[model samples]
Target: MGREFIAYIPGQKDINGQFTKANLGRTLGLLKKLLKGGLYEFGTLTAAYNGWAKGSPEYDQWMAEVAVYPTTAQNVIRDAVVNALTHVKGSNDDPIPLTIVWEGGPEGVTSRYEAAGPSWTVTITGYPPPAKSMLAERRDKKPS
Candidate 1:
């Protein structure tokens, strides 16, 4: 099977900003909100939109027929988001993909994800989670 691009689930979906999940940025519309919006947690929004090259529906479907690689996921998201943000703000600040990670400690603690670029590898190291769930939250724009 192929690895597909998807959002990293940080916590929950309805828990306000506490919960996090991966968002599929298949369109410029989604990128606008991510850039103008405040990123939850450390780099939730940043990583969520670092590359903005998340594959399109047609491309993704074709890849599924062949294979998928989340590594490429970040690229798609980053490109799209950056373009959207640039068009919106008329500025530039390239960030990496949203690696919504949760590190568990004995005393009810969790660590933020790394800010390294696409080249660096992220690994969760620490105490086992008593109960944890990181999820991505991507939604289509509301009809206007």
Candidate 2:
């Protein structure tokens, strides 16, 4: 026998089927919401993830754990950045202005000239692969 060709795995599917841009977009939007609500901390997300509902133990716990509000923090940082950016000069002696803003949430508007602080910007792309079973199910389903 030369090379062996294996059959499909039980719970693995191609990358197109599992995670999707829509899913990622929604997740990112949720993160932004959490951020604007002063819920940037990982613990806050964890609490929200665990479950967040009114009059429930999980919600209460999340509230307790989430101490900071993202809006306020972002505001303060933006103010400082704006003022500083206006003053920052390039090597040529020209002033180096800047701008930074969050894309969604109540703070939806962009702040003119620099962000509150140095931020780690990222562009997340693509979706995760689906499980084989899920793939099969999708394939089996009739077009609708």
How badly does each model clash, as a count of residue pairs? Answer: 37, 10
lDDT of 2 by residue, 20-104 (tens): 3233333344444566443354433333433444555544543442333355544444343323322333553122322222233
Per-model TM against the reference: 0.23, 0.23
lDDT of 2: 0.34
Index of the highest-TM-score prediction: 2
Poorest 10 consecutive residues by lDDT, candidate 1: 12-21
- Give the TM-score (vs. native) of candidate 2: 0.23
Please give, for residues 46-90, the per-residue lDDT of candidate 1 as tens digits. 333333234554334333421222434334433433432233223
